[model samples]
Target: MSIGNVSAVLVHGAWADGSSWSKVVERLKAHGINAVAAPLPLTSLHDDVAALNRTLERIEGPVVLAGHAYAGAVIGSTRADSVKALVYVAALAPAEGETVGDVFYRGEAHPLAPKLSPDQHGLIWLPEEAFAAAFAQNATAQELTVLGAVQRPISVSCIGEPVERPLWTDRPSWFLSAEQDRMISPDTQHFMAQRMNARVHSHQVDHTPIVTAPDVVTDVIVEAVQAVSTR
Candidate 1:
């Protein structure tokens, strides 16, 4: 099962866009790896999967599709055959017929997630205060400010929608668990990793590992690329 050369498509989580992977992307490029961040719509499962699939359709070679947080569900549902491996970066990594909301509710609540209230349009967005404390605890004041300013609203519907496919079961998988994550518990991440039989890596960082430890995150992704390419 040795794939020759493959591109890596990085997907951002809730409240984030492709820029979240800027530092990691630079590191990957420095290693002569072909990588790009797929800017997820984060509006709904259907739209997000469509966006990811479109990105996959454009890639010219086998791909290692990496997803964080909500995008994990996106990748699981939209398992493009072009994806040779799936990488979870402090991500949800739900199974088929499961939703991101189901994963969170099944596990104990993280201490920092603000009490959420959905809008009429069914979108769930963290309050501004929760942004700094829960989502970007490891980030500096300036980074937190930038995150708050650019945060995208996610539809609540996306959380409850079941993943139509389970990519991890079909492809080689990797998981990066954030030991200090306050958004999603490390225990829950471990459970998912074990269930998927993923090669696991741990970092004493926050939920946004790409922001706090971009180099290490890039290394983990590069390992997945190598594993897939040399398979």
Candidate 2:
């Protein structure tokens, strides 16, 4: 199921670094797919998009840009012509002229979802306990520990600012609606997926499925990549 010349560029969401995609990366590699996790600064939307572009610029040929959680916004911001498809894994999809927070907080959040606020430094950090309670309750204790330890605080500015026209409108897209996601509600996922007319693959997975359910995450990504290759 290898797609020749097409590679994958994975972008992690807030509170997570590139390492969050480690499991998926290994699986993609085993399938002979060139996959790399693009590191986001979590500084601001502009900065995060810049970092994503930096990664895309380095990769040759077509790419399947897959984003997790908050990174859905980052992936859609890229104007790179090489991007042939977009994949959202329990990700947020903010429409044109809308801020990430707009869609993120559209519906009611899960009862267990942590109450988040920026600290004095204006950086929003997920509570450590939220890693297990909300982010990936299905994840093992060790997985939760590592997720919290390597967490990166996202800037308040990241979600507040309105995004430019999203690239998803111009490309084929696949959405993984994590039915059991606590961070982003399933209703919200269905709303975004339907609005975008994306091919939806709903699964009973947690928010951080890239860690808790790597195979499920990779399955959607590979489907998008294969779609792009055939095009």
Candidate 3:
């Protein structure tokens, strides 16, 4: 439990690659904090968890493993004990035996998720309109254009796959709720935060808080680092 010097590993969510954390990485580095963004496969939970675990394996010292959106479930199951804490940024943070799909179905459906249907490859992607409105609601015209072009298709199977274990149960956790999130409601985020007994922070931003409010996100992450060090 005593991980000497702590670092951070950032895991991004669906439709996004690791570049989503570019500003966050820069800010953390400016403070001399070691951080790396883990690029998830996003194709399947199994593959994504493997990628996360591999990244965790390479880090030296204690780590605060942070995840956004879908990567929440990924880090939960990756079994990286070097991860002394977790920070969920508008992320799923599901309990053991619960799927991300189950969480969504139980909550009121968002207006912008799009009517999804899987192809022969079993992938599900949000329509361009929904992506623009829900995922990047706070983005400028240029950022929204870039997001549209590079978005990756997520595997439908990943949504319903239950996490075997939830890291939050064993680790100190922080949750940043995007109060203006269009894809996942603010109420649903509150429910998850309460369920996990997390130290919760709120922002008047979209689902992609890392982009819309990097400084606020960085503040919460730095607080988590301080908490772990104190403990």
Clashes of each: 2, 0, 0
Q: Candidate 3: lDDT of 124?
A: 76
- Model 1, position 205: C-alpha lDDT score: 85
Q: Which portions of model 1 show Cα errors greater than 4 Å?
A: 1-4
Regions of candidate 3 where Cα sits further than 4 Å from its true position: 1-4
Q: Pick the candidate with the highest lDDT.
A: 2
For all predicted structures, in order, the TM-scores are 0.95, 0.98, 0.94
Q: Rank the candidates by lDDT, best first.
A: 2, 1, 3
What are the lDDT scores of the predictions, listed in order? Answer: 0.85, 0.93, 0.83
Better of 1 and 2 by lDDT: 2
The lowest-lDDT stretch of 10 consecutive residues in candidate 1 is: 1-10
> What tens digits encode model 1's per-residue C-alpha lDDT throughout 1-231?
443367889999888889889888898888777888998778788889999999889988888888988788887777577888889998997777888888866677787877887888877777998877888788889888888888888988778777766878878899999998888888999999999999999989888988878987988888998988787
Please identify which of the two predictions, 1 or 3, would achieve the higher lDDT against the true structure.
1
Which portions of model 2 miss their true places by more than 4 Å? none
Highest TM-score, which number? 2
Candidate 2 similarity to native, TM-score: 0.98
